[model samples]
Target: MATRPTMPAAAATTSPDDLLRLDRQVCFALAVAARNVIALYRPVLEPLGLTHPQYLVMLALWERSPLTVREIGQLISLEPATLSPLLKRLESAGLVTRDRHPEDDRALAITLTERGRLLREQALQVPPRIVATLGMDVEELQALHASLSRVIAASTPAHQPRR
Candidate 1:
């Protein structure tokens, strides 16, 4: 671990400008933005019977079904403990199957059910709705996604979490 650099007592006690305000903090902005964006998706996702996190899971499964729980967690940045209940709820809704992998009985495989496969048609509407709701040009949103991707990569730890 690195140690904090020591500063003179007078320097440590004062700010040159009033820049330590909450509205100026990047973390505060990120937190509020994350909440508001997720809130926007709430109403949009209601008809599909999905919460924000569930939607993320569905997106992973939509791209490729029969993924292992660990793979889904890695893709979605969720821990298994957090993801388990979501999988259970999806299973109960008959949208997905949590069964043993055909090749390896010990590993759980998450495959979309027939109903879930059909839901993809409805899911196709989601992106456009979100874009309209944000009232941003697709180019701008794409730029922001690229920026956020960079932020995530820069802020993430050097070591990946254990699978």
Candidate 2:
């Protein structure tokens, strides 16, 4: 049988108070960092006429268009309720078109417009700008991304058969 690794003795010896410290809390750090990083994207995305969430949606569509609302939500880890309004706004901006799927009347297909496709040219500059603003090299950001992926996987629930 395989065994799980344990924390080192020194780390295991942390007191309850040490564990309770706000600065040491992963959730606290993640929340603050998320807000700050999103704030950094605000100015960059503003000229592109997209908020951070909208930009994320565009990024997904740029990769694969004509995805259903549910598929886009799954790709972005956003709820359908939240994504619906964002899609509407993008449609309003003429960046995308949302139409009922011919095969599945209930499903809405999201496709980027010609303007949206052209916007990708401008959007290409965003990453390099953000990287410059963050002062982090591509390698460092890649490593951070890998670490965050591990953290996300560890935090999500594992599906198991019901008893």
Candidate 3:
């Protein structure tokens, strides 16, 4: 059986200064982990012609097509300013279409094109490839996901003014 790698021990004596240490910062660790994991997706997504953010937008659209820009932003936790350029690029790639909503002149509705729909089949391979690259078991990944979800929930402010 393979042994799991262990983290280095923390200082035996806890000092107030320990709280300020770089290694002890959760935000730093989370940011590093996010960057590293996203880096792992870069090569895999390249063949599909997507950047990490574009891949996320595609994932949202795959789950539910014809979503409004606002809806996609809400689902992906991105601002419209950030998502608009992505949608425009996807539209240019012939993967998606942006149309003015029938009922709301101000709203833009995003829909997957035929190419986008077909890309889903290729995307089906991405998760398994990522799992293999991570070298983690499904159960372990699930537990980590649960813990991260808890952290996100705890860190999010209780009151958010609706946009």
C-alpha local distance difference test of each model = 0.91, 0.93, 0.94
Please, what are the lDDT tens digits per residue for candidate 2 over residues 31-136?
Answer: 9989998999999999999999999999999999989999999888899999999999999999999999878999999999999999999999999999999999
Worst 10 residues of 1 by lDDT: 10-19
Give per-model TM-scores: 0.85, 0.92, 0.88
The alpha-carbon RMSD values of the candidates against the true structure, listed in the order shown, are 5.4, 2.1, 8.1
Residue pairs with backbone atoms closer than 3 Å in model 1 (clashes): none
Ranking by lDDT: 3, 2, 1
Model 2, position 79: C-alpha lDDT score? 93
Better of 1 and 3 by lDDT: 3
Which candidate should be chosen as best, given lDDT against the real structure?
Answer: 3
The parts of candidate 1 lying over 4 Å away from their true place are: 1-17, 159-163
Clashing pairs in 2: none
As for candidate 3, its clashing pairs are: none
